[model samples]
Target: MLSGDLDISQAEGLKPMVYLVQPENFDQLGQSFVGKLLDSAEVDGRGHFEFEALKNVEGQVLLEVVVQKKGERYANRLENENPDSDNYMPLIWTRGETLVINAAIDQFQSSVTIENPSTVNASFLELRDLKKNAFLKYKNTLELLQGDEQLLEREKALHEYQAILMQFADATPELFPALMAIKWVSPEGNYERIPEFLVNQGVKWSERYPNDRWVKELAALASKEKLPILVGDQMSNLEFPMVDGSKTSLNAITDGKKLLVLDVWASWCAPCRLENRNVLLPLWQKYHDKGFQVIAYALESNRPAWENAIQKDGANRWLHASHLEGDQNPIMDSLRIHTIPANFILDGNGKVLAKNLHGEDLVQFVANYLGD
Candidate 1:
């Protein structure tokens, strides 16, 4: 059972309600991709609430406690909403233990403190706070440095941060916190390989916490064969319905004829919007007739917003497709994409020629390949 007391005595106006949310792995737009409304209750005049949860035997589950006005609509924490206003805080749960939380409405996230068997959760919080403090301390110092000096300072800070996290993970005596902290800064991009230190730690953790969900997930991530698709790898096939109810497929459109740029993006992603305006558009104009095509596959939940972005960004020239399922879209899952503004450039033979080409590099890559 999970129980908590919300000290909303200082809160003004409407009576607040507390919601127990089984938060999704990632957020879609302003909402959880697949959040389950596990439980909800109106806080009494004294401000207390409780909910029974199934034992998380496999591993820790990330649950969210959302406190808001009785009928007020608001966005989830990942949507960049006012965190303090929503009184958002993430909670972790494990099997065979009862957890309690005490939070004041005014203080919310920062003032949150847990009770009984929250050792792992508490340690993770402390680690995160340490990182936050480092960022604050170095914010001004970073601005004063130039070029390589700035880069070196930032790298030094990152290394120090990782060392501190490792020390916490080593001494915490909890698999959940250790696994999370180790995986948090795992490598990605062209060098999509887990660090040796993390791999060794994962091996020890797996031995310690056998059949643990996160351990297995981290082990898979640490595995060499699980690397992300690179520039030379074959592109994953994706087929889905367009807004007009027309079907689109990467293989079908490319058809081993024109080179295809598989642009995986979303309307809500600011980086995606910037790349479309500054990179994709110019490349399209230069290479369209020379047998280059762009399949702008949008991962969006809102049909109107997706269409609006296309119109606003002048991206209607290419074939666009999406089921508007956002992060829940199967195509996204197949590609193992958790972030947006990702792309793959495919040759006429339906093999990946390059990936994540950007700015002048995007134009140059296409122009060089086509001999234009």
Candidate 2:
């Protein structure tokens, strides 16, 4: 059970949400609070709220207690233009234990305190302070630099920032915060440090428990980072709701095509739209009738934005599909598409021949395969 007390008197009409995040997708907490809303409670006259329905939930998932504003569908990152801050705190809950919290209304995280913290979360405060201090130091030292800064000083700052993360990970190798810190150390999302850190930490843990699936899964993330679902691999048979609210299947769409280009993109991505209009659209116009097709597959969250981009790009002639789940899309996960504007060339059988084609090279590739 998770119970908390907050003085909503300073700011009324807002709601408190408890987001239950899966260990694998814990990064969602940094983004927004939507389908992850495990439970919510009203702040009573006594300034108290409680969530007891988490007993049926499995595993040691991260919890986010956020105060969402009225009329707002969800709370994302703070807008620097608006100056108002988002009120929330990260938490980890263990079953069979009661975690109590007390936080202020104005400064949610600054004055927060916990009672009966989980064993895994015991080092949270220390790590949190280190992170906060490191960020301040970065802002004061690095962010203020205009170009006269030494390359070595910059590297030292980055190293220090990274070391704080590594310090936390090394201190609590099995903790979820440690895993989260790993996400930052590797800016590309895929690098040597990811699996290296996991394996290094798991050395002692694995000796104690050889068949630990946690260690296995953490190690497995490294392979997925290599983008294993491309070049000779057959596309997964899947269907998604189109703009017309009709379901479209990838395999079904490629039925009679000599070649099909799967363009994975999002509306927010400027390069994606630019490529669609400048490159992909023209390619479709030229080669579409000559046994070629394009599936404008969107890893999008907004239906209106997705539809607007399609209409604006004049890509109505091509096939389009999306579940509108954005990062939560299962296809993106299965495909291991960590970046946008990503594409793949698939044959009639839906087997990928080449991946990430764009600009002149993409046009040349099409010409080589299906000459104009």
Candidate 3:
């Protein structure tokens, strides 16, 4: 048997109502059942009912509920709108409340806060547990780093950051906002290392949850970075055929060049073809003599189309080549080229300088690097 009480008081204007559920009853219901129960709640006229529900996976029940007024919009809007926002929904867990799940009645309030920004209070016991796990993982990794006498301090710090990120990845889905917070605080220079960790985590997550959209997105993001690294680091040793039917090594092609831009594109890709007219042609014309060069690697299954597109685009001024086998191109496979119109910029000595820079950024990057 289970029961609970919800109370709402208004002296004058309308205010949000509080819903409370006993932890014992919540634990008995299971996540799916509890989710349905919460779904049945009355929708107030204020656009949505924002509440927090606690669940125990093993117990299969909800423990408690905390209600608050939904923020004006969803918390995740920052990802698409601002690209940078520290505001994450807070999840608080008390003695009886072991898990905090936030839900909004309307789609606009989809995002939930992981930690209360207004109070800066870490009252949530679940947050403490996550932090504890992260600290333990960091300590273990730090010990390993200490044992390696030959490893530089810089390498140790990189490994330690990776360890902490792994802890965040292992956290529950509800704790994602907190994970994002940690990611935000991470140094930008570690993006390369971090993506590798994320890819591993994505693989693990995909295995655990077979058909999750978010998991797929995470995996794609990780895989995206791997493409450049594979080409710049591992495949640099191999020689490939140029459009003129002559063989050339990537190292030889880029020798002594201050910057080399690899444009992995296809004649069939509309965006790739479109950029030739609007973006690439102009930029190349302006920067070719300024120590910047483009190497367009076309992936066209049809040899004629590849040749035709090259001629039509007037790409003669730059280095253009194609394997004439679409996805079957060994270079494409080596680089894990999943999307068309991809690009990478490498500085002198074959070091990757920037990736996926498009439109204004691409032009600006060349200007900045060439001191224009």
Candidate 4:
């Protein structure tokens, strides 16, 4: 007897059909059992049934057969024709079917009793393909390692890992377990390699899946690490427009001054805004005549907010200006301003003296710089 479930709904108007025959007595079995079974049945689209032969025979072979109207080739063509289509349904395959059976076998080996011998035999075949994929990834990684001297070779290795990750992303939920296992086996090298790997993968990910969570997460990780993640050279000798609409270059701000404090800040930045209230204002007032000058660069995206902050905080006493474009501000980009509430204290002749000074530290820093 042969029995199994079949889903023909996706076939639309196509009918379900099957032919079964015994290899030993093909003519006899076909004329009797196979012909009789086809004569009594009507099948279309989707349905399930069970069957059993009435006669009890010793040492007799039984063959079960099933066929769906749609197969892998049809599904592949549909996917190829419509890239964004989600019409393909998951089907049992050599690898996938093996993974399912193997998982069950593993569970059974771990203590559960296996009442089926068919599952054990099917699991053995499934594991071979799983191992084959694992070996392929390993072999590729080794090949990548062989040509490490060339930059293009390293890029190729990075691409291989990225391709694997993309496959995992596109896989169905049922296939995820095996895909994840493959991903786990793929080697992720040290921190030095991480930046390059992420950069290459990030570009592909952004292009393919714009709103993917992994891309954002990877970007955040790279950003937080202070990696050279942003593609650009460090800004030097930048000229910025002051709040009064007068232009002042960084060189001019530092020129003829005993010490120049290039305070990079914004109105929206609570920390920068609060610095005046905390200690900077009082210190600046006390030290202005003692050769201290502040050139505050506002990195505010809003012009109104920048002006409002400067006025409200009484920051007028300082040499203030802004490009009014936040991160895109030419001066900030030139300075490579990664973190806010940052500043560079420069000595006479426009050379950097100290960077990122704040609070009482700024007072102590100046006192030490001036030998006070």
Candidate 5:
């Protein structure tokens, strides 16, 4: 049972509705809250609420409590303004423990305190803060180092930071907190880290605790990140809905074109944005009339960043579509795309010709085909 006492006396005019949400996917840069609604409650006049008997919800999961004055409208406003902040704290619930929360309306996190099941989560929260501070220091140190010659040194520094994060993950008593720490420190939805952090760590934990339910759950989650797509596979079709509520498919844009660049990217991806602005846009402008088309497939959780990126990056002329589920999209399941700025050059009949041909190489590929 999850029970909380809301303190609205501190800040008036706040709504009484509180929503419990589950994680769906990360926004572009491991930011934003894209999740499914699990439960909701309206606090009484005395600011009391309870979610009792949450049955059949098996395994370890991170639950978010979203309390607000204006439901959805306020959430949307936060997404538009920040695109990152959740405006709430995450509850890392473990087995055989019920989480109790006390939060005020003025500043949710500032006034919030965890009461029950504090043994594991207290240390986890402290470790997370330390990791944040360490990363900040790492960034500052990186900024001081300049030039290509020092890139190896920079990489070393990053690896050391990752090591500290891995240590924290290992030290956690629960699987969920460990996994959460890994995600918190690692790059956004990075497939490489899945193996190093999740896969490897999961195996060790599973062997150590053969009968542990949390370990099994952690392994199951890690298994989902395995790469399924390859370079030579036939390009799969995706019917993604567009900005105007209209829908478009991959086959539709690939038709009647000699070649098409299936650009898989996201708005929060700085490298992807840079390539779109500096290289892809220019190439698209030059060869658009010559049967060389570009279709930008955004892996984004929010509509604003996805749409704004299209307009801001001059990619509006080309075909664009996203489910706004980011890495969790069904399309990604069939496509097996693990990373952004990834592309597959498709032939006239929608066969994969070349994979990830960027910048001058992309220009050369199209130019070679067009005999320019």
Candidate 6:
């Protein structure tokens, strides 16, 4: 149970709510976390509140406690949001444990602290605080060193900042904190170290928490990094069910083509449909006869919607295929298509040329590739 004295600076005009973060959407932190509403508490004039129902949760689940005004949207701790206005803090609530939080509502994230936390929660707090401190210390240093003459100093500062995270991630044996620290510096922040961290860190977690849901998800991400998804890397073969219910591979479609666009989209995505009409269709019309082709792969569950979208958009000229699995589509996982409208331009021999080109860039690239 989360029982504590919440010191709301102005106790009256505020409402406090608690929510459980869905396991699948845990990676999308600070985005939209309006998950299952577990409970709400009323604060007295003295600014004291409690959630008795927060006791005996099934397991160690992620929770967000937010204090917002009535009818106000649920608040998250965004990096860009004003610190004074943040009304939320993340919690790792463990079963059979009691966490007492004493915090001010106005500065919820920064002011919140727990007394005697579980192992998971303790690690979480330590890493979270470390991240905040590092950001404060390094953000200005990096910015000030942005000039070409200070490139070495900037690189040194960047490495020093990342080194802190890397060392923390390596040392913190707790699952959530290690994962959180790893994500903070992954792909963009840590770049080349993604594979190494995933392998070394992932192997430990995989063995320790083998059947855990989040562990499995992170394992998937680690596997994706191993696959060749870069420009100039030769793409592996992908086979999916055609609209006519025939199996066709991507390699088979690229025969005798100067360039091919491997378009990954979904029927339900409005932006995808708009791109089809605005960019892809025009490019297709102009270059279809000149040996430029497209294989539009839809991550769709509804076959009718898939067929209807293509028909509605008058995009029947392009070859279309799907596994009819929507977000759970195997093709999505195989190609690391976390979000679509994702695309890759390919050469005749199946090497990637460019990726995710859209709008004027798409038009310019295709036109330049296939000239008159």
lDDT of candidate 5 over 150-245, digit per residue (tens)? 543465566666777788877767655565566665545454423445666768778878677656665675663464343455777768677677
Q: Estimate TM-scores for all models.
A: 0.45, 0.48, 0.51, 0.39, 0.43, 0.51
Task: Name the weakest run of 10 consecutive residues (lDDT summed) in model 2.
Answer: 77-86
lDDT of each: 0.64, 0.66, 0.51, 0.47, 0.67, 0.71
Summarize candidate 2's per-residue lDDT along 1-372 as a digit string, tens digits.
788887666765555443333333623434443326666666677778887678877766676666666677654422111102435556677776688888765556445678866565556555555666665676577765554224334545665676887777777655556655564454335543234454555454455445656545545554434544736677888676777789878888889999999888888876777778888889999998899998877988888888999999998889888888886787677676666667889999989888776777789999899987
Task: Put down candidate 4 lDDT per residue, 204-259, tens digits, no spaces.
Answer: 44565556454455445434244422322222466878788788677777666788
Give candidate 4's error at residue 243 in angstroms.
0.8
Candidate 3 vs. truth: CA RMSD?
Answer: 14.1
Q: Please report, as a residue range, the 10-residue window in candidate 1 with the lowest summed lDDT.
A: 185-194
> Which stretches of model 6 miss by more than 4 angstroms?
10-25, 28-31, 69-71, 75-87, 142-162, 186-195, 224-372
Candidate 4: give the clashing pairs: 8-45, 235-334, 242-321, 243-321
For lDDT, candidate 5 versus 6, the one ahead is 6
Q: Which predicted model would earn the best lDDT?
A: 6
Candidate 4 TM-score, true structure as reference? 0.39
State the lDDT of candidate 1 residue by residue for 1-372, as single tens digits: 677787886777534766767654322112443456566666777878777545433465666666654456543322212223435556678655688888886556555678754666787567545544544454545567566323434444555545665666666676655654563332121123224455556577778876866667657655534545555667656676876888877678888556888888888876677777777887788888888888888989899999999988878877788978877887767665565566778887668777666556678888888877
Worst 10 residues of 3 by lDDT: 74-83
At residue 357, candidate 6 shows an lDDT of 70
**Candidate 4 lDDT trough over 10 residues, lowest sum:** 75-84
Which regions of candidate 2 deviate over 4 angstroms?
A: 7-35, 58-61, 69-71, 75-88, 147-155, 184-214, 223-372
lDDT of 4 at 234: 24
Which residue ranges in model 3 land beyond 4 Å of their true spot? 1-95, 98-104, 108-176, 180-235
